[model samples]
Target: MLMYKVTKENGKTVYTPHFPPPLAALDGKTVELQGYMIPITSGFRHNTFMLSVLPIQQCMFCGQNGIPAMVEVILSDSKKEKMSERPVTIKGKTVLNRKERNRLEIWVTDAVIM
Candidate 1:
């Protein structure tokens, strides 16, 4: 789902993603993902964060991964999870950003740790 085609826009590099049919079909749908939590704020428990496909060692924040490797996560109302090194399984509605290359490519809203 992270696959993209690189191109030149205004003499600057731009990445335009082409989502596969199956992946595209998941937009606005609930899906489960297993990943390490990358907090948006410094804390032990969080309601919003980023879920990375890779562990912190090679996470997006470390510059070892790209936008596709992570998804912004917003937990369900009043729900929070403690940050941990172990992977977590989350079920949420998927939001795909197909037009914005400078922002997160995906977001999981109303997520819950399962």
Candidate 2:
């Protein structure tokens, strides 16, 4: 059970999990996550949705590859009828590995296709 706020403000608060927590090991492990869809790179793909791991209020206009360490997951396909501003629950086996001083990115393996 973990949660990261992906909202950004003038003084946005950054989130960090405890030591040796599941935040990094989620890869190859079945886990559930809940957050909003972050379509990066100007939403050109129109099919790719990234999970916002941190609280980011300002939508990124560039440097999509440099998303916050809160964890931005690339989805499998278009599961949502339309992008919802509210948060949603995502369950699947996390995959991929990403780490920084205070950041971690884990891509889920088997998302519910939504």
Which candidate leads in TM-score? 1
Where model 1 places Cα greater than 4 Å from the true spot, the runs are: 63-68
Best by lDDT: 1
Each candidate's lDDT (Cα)? 0.85, 0.54
lDDT of 1 by residue, 43-103 (tens): 8999988888788878755777574378889999968888999999999999988887566
lDDT of 2 by residue, 1-114 (tens): 455545456897655433346555654777778876666546434344666744346445344545554344545554433455777677777754433433244565446634
lDDT of 2 at 54: 42
Model 2, CA-based lDDT? 0.54
Candidate 2: residue 80 lDDT (0-100) = 36
Candidate 2, superposed: residue stretches over 4 Å from native: 1-24, 41-47, 53-69, 74-81, 98-104
